[model samples]
Target: MALSEITTRLTAAAQAHGRDASGITLIAVSKVQPAERVEAVLTEGHRVFGENRVQEAQGRWPAFQEQFGGIDLHLIGPLQSNKVRQAVEMFSAIHTVDRPKLAKKLADLAQERGTCPDLFIQVNTGEEPQKAGCLPSEADGFISDALAMDLPIKGLMCIPPIEEEPTLHFALLAKIARRNGLEGLSMGMSSDFEKAIAQGATHIRVGSAIFGERVPG
Candidate 1:
């Protein structure tokens, strides 16, 4: 589908949930998508995008930025400690900060570089052992730690277990955000973004639905 169509649907979905569509940010997840596909969306004037890998983003975004100024790029996947400096420099937002070590590194880097992207602590709401987020129970402490370091934490983020009801996870994330006095809730994807909107998601990351299915490497 085209960017316009996806955006129109997103706006309608948000409105159906009594949300102001203008308040929601649409992140076109461009991980693993070729540059041409990203360019297609850029051509449609879609500026916010999400990327999974720092290396991949480093390879693609500089060129895209040269052509399209004012683009917002969010890093939405697992982040390695060693890559914290580069990640801080590249992304406009970092959405997978789930541990104290990573949070501290980001804080230090931001202090050194004098630039910090908005931060979101990813919560493993499902308590999935293999996932990359911090346990839901540990989120409060983690957020506290990040804040103590003066990290620019915006809110919480989560990826619900694929087989479970996503709304439940979305609600949990919303509750977490509210309890912590946060305003940004980076939950939802192509499959359940509308439900997420109803649950108060401020940022919805949609990839396949907008750029088509990923081409397997």
Candidate 2:
């Protein structure tokens, strides 16, 4: 699928749910894609992109930026504490702050630099043991702690268990965001972004649907 088609669908999804499509930001997940594919999207005027690995982004984006002046990058994968500084410097947003220690590290970086990317608290809505988000039970306190640090927390993010009904998880995430006064919901991907928008997703991360599947290295 092309970027325009995916964008049109996202817009339609937002409209169908009484949302302004313009309010939702589509992040092109560019991790592991060929440079030509990414450059093609940039040529089409896509500014928002997501990268899973800080090291990969460090090696990739600089040259791309030299070529395309405005790129809004996001970190949509698990973040290690040691990588926080690089992630902070590189991404326009960080969507995987799942623990107090990670949050504290981000807070300290924001303090030292006087600027930080917009943040989203990752909630393990499905209680998936192997996933990277904070458990649902731990989210409230975690969000509270982040707020106290004056972090630029924009909203919440979640990746539903692949086999479950995503609507249930999306609704749960929405409920959590509402209570916490968060408007940004960084959910959804190539397969179910429409559903995410229907549940009030302010940002949807779409990758393979746009760039095609990655060739595993």
lDDT of 2 by residue, 1-217 (tens): 4999999999889888788888999999999998889999999999999999999999999999989988999999999988999999899899999999998999888899999999999999999889989998888888999999999899999999999989899999999999998888999999999999889888899999999998665
Range of the 10 consecutive residues with the lowest summed lDDT in candidate 1:
1-10
Residue 141 in candidate 2, Cα distance off native in Å: 0.9
- What are the candidates' C-alpha RMSDs? 0.9, 0.8
The residue pairs found clashing in candidate 2 are none
**Candidate 1 off by > 4 Å:** none
User: Could you tell me the TM-score of candidate 2?
Assistant: 0.98
| Alpha-carbon deviation at 150 in model 1, angstroms | 0.6
- Model 2 alpha-carbon drift over 4 Å, by segment: none
lDDT of 1 at 91: 92
User: How many clashes show up per model?
Assistant: 0, 0
Q: Which digits, one per residue and each the tens of the lDDT, describe model 1 over residues 135-162? A: 8888888888889998999999999999
**CA lDDT of each candidate?**
0.91, 0.93
